[model samples]
Target: MTRTVLLNNLDHQDLRVITRRSAALGDAVMLAHTFPAEFRDLQAHYPIVFQKSADGTTFHPVALLGLQDGQNLFLDESGWTGHTLPLAIEREPFYIGQDGDEWLVHIDLDSPRLSRTEGEPLFLPHGGSSEHLERMTSVLLALHEGLQATPAFVSALLRHELLESFVLDVEHADGSQGRLAGFYTLNEERLAQLDGPALAALHQAGHLQAIYMVLASLSNFRTLIERQNQRQAARA
Candidate 1:
């Protein structure tokens, strides 16, 4: 369980966050939650897809990192290979919390990234927030807003009937195979067939580009597979 408490400089004066990418630091994830606002940057390095929520209530967008659970192909000896990382992945140890009607920032005390002697400082010597903290605040704000806007984006896609189930089959060089399922993506056929009025509405809402970005990101599936194969080969 995550132990969360409201962050304050007094209690966390010496708090530091290790920014290095490593599996032991909780960087190994199957997929990271993303939003329409991040699709453009994320599409360049990761495959974007939508999956049903835990209760099957709704769907949210995610950037795929690996085919299997607890495996992130992006992490290596040096660091994450991608130039751009999903905001959800970058916002480690820090999370947004709700205290009644107010939003607050909370940090996981048990996270490996939390350190007192190494990495970026959360506060300055004079007890003011550091530049790193400011950037993290901005990221959290963007994430909060982006998550709030995602339902509308998903509604738009559902209204246009553009979401379709997808399955991926992978064949490794060593005669191993894997299949990925339980995800959805934009159907180009349906997107192209959208009526002009619907298309116009989506365009007006700034969702058309996001749809295309999600589609474009599918190409990264090959990139992920290659990474997995490379890791497998290295282990052999």
Candidate 2:
């Protein structure tokens, strides 16, 4: 359960947030919510895919981190091994909220990242937002804007029939097999068959690069398998 409240300088002035990467910090996950703006960086380390909501009426982009639930291949004793961590994962315990029409910052007071002993302070000695807070504020803003734009992006993808459900069959080094399902990816063949006018429209909308980034990110499946194999070997 999350105890979220509007962040204010008065009630939570001494609050500090730990930024360290560890399983204790709740980093174990197979995917993180992502946006097209982050597809480029995420493609380099994580496979970008579209995940449908539980109701199956909506979709959102995510960066794949592991083959199964409760597993993050990027996290080891040395910390997250990916070259770039997704902003969605970095923006921990802090979420953007709306008080009427105004956007407000909210913090999860019960998050493991919260600490009173040692960590980045949310405010300075004089009751002003600190640099860390400023950075977090920026992250919140970007995430808010990106999420707002995601609907249009998804609409465009659906308009062009670009999303397709797919499954991944994984064979571990020890000969055990696993399957990853319930995810969607861009249909490259269909994308290639799009009409010139449609292609131009998608290009003008800046979704062309994002689509290719998702395709390119599939190469990292090998990286994920390697990491998983390494971990299995270590355990052995």
Candidate 3:
């Protein structure tokens, strides 16, 4: 259950949010939604891929964190090991909502991260925004803007038929195998076959770099498999 309400210094003056990463805090997931604006940072740490909405109407990008459900390979007792956390993961317990023509910050009152005596304070002693609050606001703003731009990026990919379905089969050291499917990836061949004008158009829109980032990110799948293997060995 959730009790989401518009944030205010008075009502939430004493609120503190736990900033640590852990599965108990809802960080155990196989993937996190990502946007083109974040591709560069994400490419270095995760395999970027695409998944269709449940309704099969549209596509969105995600940073793969594990091979199986309810697993996050980058998470450990010390916290996330990735070079960067996806904005979707970073903007937890707070969301942006529209109140008429204005955007307002909303807080999840039921979140386990919330507390009164521990973690980062949301407001200063004088009831003003604290540094932590300011940083969270910036994260929320960037996430909002990035999500607003995602549709155009997805549209561009679809218009060019650059998305292709793929299946990955993995074999662990224990001779166990796993298969991942129902995801899409950039079609390098189609992208390469584009004419000069098409290439120039993609470049102008700044999607060309994002596309390559997605391609480069695929290399990290090897890293993910290695993490999975290590986990398996530990369990054994």
Candidate 4:
């Protein structure tokens, strides 16, 4: 059998380990990529379809981490519309690929330097633009999934340019839920104020550093601000 590990060239920067999967008897980590057990132990406490065969049973990563080789690694499934995970799942692991159960993801290289063969390692390689787009979309979707928590996440999303504009979808004591679109700009001053968790929340919101785009639109905002000030002075 041949297994291809895509995006081998990606630089796993700021790679934070969110959660791990374990096994029965609780002796080892569950590395189920191979045989009888193939499940992703999502570190999050959310309910998930751990294994296809298991029914009506929802468990967290701790339950599965008993198997050392059963498999255990971080599961950063924050921005997921997919809170639930499955066992023995394989995916293109990028945005531009198919979307569904056990969606997988990883970063892509600016220029993927493809070696002649798969096994042999080489200097950095390059993939095509389509691959790049896939990476971008994949990250965006993942980012969107990560922002479900944290107070004022919506405001943070707007600041980060993840949501172009939003309207009150529903209002309640809990807070407001709204639909988000468009993108925004971000600045160092603004970013530095947020904690790591907050930034992760914004990213999971599918902002994709959307702040850069909003920054590009600063001139429009300045104009609007000036116009409003002039109008206010005229009224006074």
- Candidate of highest lDDT: 3
lDDT of 1 by residue, 100-128 (tens): 99878898888899999999999999999
Candidate 3 regions with alpha-carbon error over 4 angstroms: none
The TM-scores, one per candidate, come to: 0.96, 0.97, 0.97, 0.19
Please write out the lDDT profile of model 2 over residues 48-114, one tens digit for every residue.
Answer: 8899988889899999999999999999888888889888898898999987999889999999999
Q: How much lDDT does each candidate structure score?
A: 0.91, 0.90, 0.93, 0.32
* Order of quality (lDDT): 3, 1, 2, 4
How does residue 117 of candidate 2 score in lDDT? 87
lDDT of 4 by residue, 92-148 (tens): 122222247544443323212222333123222452233444434444454434322
Q: Give candidate 1's root-mean-square deviation (CA, Å).
A: 1.3
Q: RMSD for all candidates, in order, please.
A: 1.3, 1.0, 1.0, 21.7
- Residue 160, model 4: lDDT of 54
Residue-wise C-alpha lDDT for candidate 3, range 116-183, written one tens digit per residue = 98899999999989888888898898988988999989999999999999999999979999998989
Clashes of each: 0, 0, 0, 49
True-structure lDDT of candidate 4: 0.32
Clashes of 3: 0
